[model samples]
Target chain A: MTVTKGDVERLIDASIGAAPAPTMDQVKEFVTKTLDYNFAMTLTEPFYIKPNAEILHAAGKKLCTVISYPLGSYTHEAKLAQLKQALADGADECDIAMDVSAFKSGQYDKVKEDLKPCVELMGDKVCKLLYFASLLTEDEQKRAIEMAIDLGFPMLKTNPGFGFSTTVDQVKLAHDFAGDKIGIMVSGGVRTKDDAIAFVEAGVSRIATSAAFQIMADFDK
Target chain B: MNKKELAKYIDQTDLTPGEPYDKITEFCKDAAENGFASVCILPTLVKTAAAALKGTDTKVCTVVSFPLGMDYPEIKEIETKEAIENGAEEIDMVMNVGALKGGDYDIVNDELARVSKACHDKGVLLKLIIETTLLTDEQIVKACELAEANGVDIVKTSTGFKKMLPRSTSVEDVQLIRAHIKPETGLKAAGGIRTTEDALKMIEAGATRIGASSGKDIVDGLAE
Candidate 1:
């Protein structure tokens, strides 16, 4: 079981989000670093989409922007507007945040309604439906996966990482439920190469992390 | 300041992610009864807070683009309009921090102008959150200038989201922005303001409003 740098890079979704805001230089440096690693994609906010689009495309790497972000409290209309604009801003993928409160409150209809238009707008693009899996019940996780599959989202991202920890078991659960019908992206808390390897072995289709460089640096050691 | 007077300067907040509606309604009821300035909440709960605080003096303040503030100006404007329609009296819209930090003042100005117009069109007060913890002193002053130029009614400090770097609002942040803006423009100090003393320091530094989750405790501390 030898893990190489390419193994890590092939499955890694390198991400760099500054605490409050990122300067153009910081964004540029990070994009360059991620591209140097030749990771699968770069997860960024909508603000960086247009500025980083050309470089990301030239490298044949995807640019994913999260709408509604770590907290999915925005209304359906707000989510739709952000999704439309992010795509217009040249994002290759839009990871739509789930309305966790509505889903947690048993307002399944409201959650579905909130995501329907976003999924429709994303159409054939890589739309990853993100859920704060660390906070949900098993039934809730299942429902989220099923809904994403039904809504035609190609990927399911577990958690948005701003303190939310995505367990290997959660990735396995999503993999078991979706099979090959939906790709599973494990986000948040995968800070080490070993953590990434465990998730990849657990059937995770991709890994999104702010610690991509650290994980790659630790690959041999 | 006494409890009653201090209460008028506080925006009782509960932006905890995934908080239930019932809890928000209860929190709003409590804040309204306590006579806090407003109850800052997520956009989804603005309607609930509005209903709970109806017939009370406390206004409903909701966030747009929230902690990140990186959304396009158009989306921020849409969020402002929707929150206002849902009964938000005051909007704490996150300024496009990335634009401001990237030296893209045009993008920052466009966002401020758009959200300001949306909020002002509905006669809703707009507080532009600069996330002071992330900026340099110079950037903070520039942010105040851009916020004022766009007709922002208030300049807020942070989203209090507990970021990777883990910074908080300081009295100097409030004072710096206060000194830069016109006297008529309001200043709000949020993020890590938990104690009565913390609230007073912000007010002393020229903060006209305080956004805190511990509004009740601060007010009660003054009461006792």
Candidate 2:
């Protein structure tokens, strides 16, 4: 069965990371072209910092910025500053990476503290915490998901597209842990429409990918 | 150079994506033990590295706008400030390659100046990664000129994420950058200096700093 346009749009977080920095024109092209198919534009901090958030918002696009990006190891203060700047730049959503190192070191308090400020600052805007699921053990992952739930985060993302590909098992783990309270976003290696469908079938609420355009095109076929 | 001497020029790096805290801790430990100049990591790890290397001479260095330096000037400046506040002693930022290549020197110069000032205000050194692998020799020279003119502390060669170009750091590129930069300004060779011999050749070609993930191995090779 072919995926509906609404289904593609609802489940896709169009990303522009891993590639070289795109020019303003390129970002415009991306924003304009994917306006119909993408749920939001997940841009790297720099690209998000460019003065296009207003335009994207005008075009009815949700501007999402990655905080501390692929490595969620920033000090609380640094991440706070980044969140504030992105918000000031008109970002409607914040996809932050949890401090993976702190989490791994069993410094859950530090990790919680690191994420707290962004959630507080984001206020009503969408705030999705990236857990980098492959880096964490089952218990750690569960604890992280529980913390995110406690923190009132509406979404929990897996992988930052840097480490291991976001597997269905990991998505299922998040799904099993979160159930319906937290929306799951699976990123990293969901490059094709089939991958996106597999993830959606596995119970992921969203798919973060740099190849959203290609995936949507493939779905049309 | 001997192992001890070579250590002074190394900025032990682990900018690997998704690097864990334990690994960063280990990298900092190795850097301090090896007498390396600094431990270069993603900006997120600056505080951890600073804490790990406290009381040591090794500095805490973090990347700004990172492997791809296309962020707005305001963002880079903010990132530099945040890094310094988090205990980063040095900032290695990528120049806007598209702007530089497009001959938008004004945009490039302006961004560098803003970030350079942020680093200088904190007494933190700033390195501009030109990503030599992606540029023409002429573009490289222009970039070096802009970097030196803007008072960047060092001009770095690559971010080690060779996407569209070869990732190697050539001695000739170092010489070319060294040729354009002032004597006081340093040159850092990164991206592909994987061996002791490669590091030495870069140093011989006038690189004052070496950014490498293979710091331990390179230092180990120096012993033999």
Using DockQ, give the best candidate's number: 1
lDDT of each: 0.86, 0.81
* All DockQ scores: 0.64, 0.33
Error of 2 at B114 (Å): 3.1
- Tens digits of lDDT, candidate 2, A85-196: 7787788888988878767778889778878877989898888989888888898889999999988799998887753588899999989877999999888898888898
| Candidate 1 regions with alpha-carbon error over 4 angstroms | A1-3
Model 1 TM-score? 0.95
lDDT tens digits by residue: candidate 2, B124-180:
899999989878899999999899889989999998865434568899999999999
Residue A19 miss distance in model 2 (angstroms) = 3.8
- For residues A1-221, what per-residue lDDT tens digits would candidate 1 score against the true structure? 86567877888888885444777677777887777777878877877788787778888877888999878888778888888888887888888888887777777888888888888888788888887888888888999989888888889999988888899889888888889999998998989888988888899888898888898889757
Write one digit per residue (lDDT tens) for candidate 1, span B40-106: 9998888878998999999999999977887878888888888888899999998888788788899
Spell out the clash pairs found in candidate 2: A73-B44
Global fold similarity of model 2 (TM-score):
0.89
Docking class of 2: acceptable
- Best TM-score goes to which candidate? 1
Which 10-residue window of candidate 1 chain A scores lowest in summed lDDT? A17-26
- TM per candidate comes to 0.95, 0.89
